[model samples]
Target: MTGLTHHFLKMNGLGNDFVVLDLRREPLALTDALARAIADRDKGIGCDQLITIEEPRHGGDAFMGIRNQDGGTVEACGNAARCIGRLILDETGKDAVVIETLGGDTVATRADDGNITVDMGAPRLRWDEIPLSEEFQDTRGIELEIGPLGNPIMHSPGVVNVGNPHAVFFVDDADAIDLERSGPMLEHHPLFPERANISVAEVLSPTHLKLRTWERGAGLTRACGTAACAATVAAIRRRKTERRITVSLPGGDLTVEWLPDSENGPGHVLMTGPVMLDYEGDLDPALLSGAAA
Candidate 1:
């Protein structure tokens, strides 16, 4: 593939950055090594996740394949959906777009303020849906804790799955804890068979929260759209907040709303945020071969 150049776009939602490859026109086989090489901060394009846009398989506008910086594939990415949604909307001059993802189908639409709003679908709270290592009668607060059993530093995280599994721990102050030290451990905890996105959320009011996330496969991220969705749902389940709330992350603030489960609605989690197009460029094919610049 040397001497060939692949066009790519660098984009970010809030501050969770990504390298997007629109392979709809021409499909390109992506390998783990190539993904890692492309995500290398110093030697490569550098991003939190690598996104591949493909033709939709389920009657949607497009399909998005997400790979973490470590080159591991995962299901669902909220920010990426909004970014891709905007692309599709602009291309088609439409107000809404449905994006198919491994996790599920998400609906993205243009907001009144020009920001993108993605309907992340309903939260999966069943113990089996979350696929915990053990069965629990109630998933609102699982029986998992960090530190010593007698005096644990963190415990009883409210777990939910918004396309992917997540464990949200409500704290008095999100900045008080050292997430860099705690995120990896919690993400890999035995309670979660598929691992989890770890988050610490501090509720400032019934409608406001401060959050930080240790994303699985990716380390600490400035912003995680799913994490915000999970935290908002978790807080609502615990009666800590209302159905609608604003979650502030290290990168910025996002609006998360859990619709009421009514006869007419199934209660989907809606996430609204901003995405920016940083730049566009082509990848030197030699980079895939680890060649010198």
Candidate 2:
């Protein structure tokens, strides 16, 4: 915790912000407590997640490690991929780079218009893959609900695991529900043993949808790229939308496309969006040592 301070980049994808540390060169022993301190809004750097760039284990360009605000590690983050991709692309002058994560490796390519497009691999639709607590014949709609027994406020969510588990409810109004209240409840529901990201989506048209997500470890998020991907895949499976669509979240819009299964391979989900660099600074020694708060 002593020595030279570590440098970090503050960035966001539609307000789903992160504090990124480059651990590939000068590695730091990042503990859970330190990660929590960095994510604390008042006492620390403050971000939805803490990201680290490390030496790739799978021969990819770099490995992206994600830790939620709660200091728990999880696999996959689409927004983070874009931000990291931009950094790698800028560093190497490459049009694309493969970002390795615990969930899988995603190929991030520079779009013609300057946006970044990440191939988030394929969505996992099986019950066991989603890792539901119990078996279900179909994942298009699962038997789970909230509210009174006879009448529920929300029910039958389309469950899928883009990188992590998510249950997306098709709702009449995306903003009507009290996500701050219901989100935590559904995220911890028994149906999801590993917990889940809860989302309320309203289909605007065949190619557009409005969404709000209660990210699993991060709580209510301004935008969740994986949730957006999950919602689009679920929507397409339900015949509620086309193969490709624009998903608008509280922070901004993300274009998500579900590539259909072709002769070559299975379908993959593509997410394209903007990334922003807010600032760059070194971490305070006190903050890293648990003395800042």
Best by TM-score: 2
Off by over 4 Å in 2: 291-293
lDDT of 1 at 57: 99
Residues 141-205, candidate 2: write the lDDT tens digits: 99998889989999999999988999999999989999999999999999999999999999999
lDDT values of the candidates? 0.90, 0.93
Which candidate leads in lDDT? 2
Candidate 1 per-residue lDDT, tens place, 109-216, comes to: 998687999999999999899879899888889887777779877778999999999999888778988889999988888888888999999999999999999999
Q: Which stretches of candidate 1 lie over 4 Å from their true place?
A: 291-293
In terms of lDDT, the poorest run of 10 residues in model 2 is 284-293
My TM-score estimates for the predictions, one after another, are 0.97, 0.97
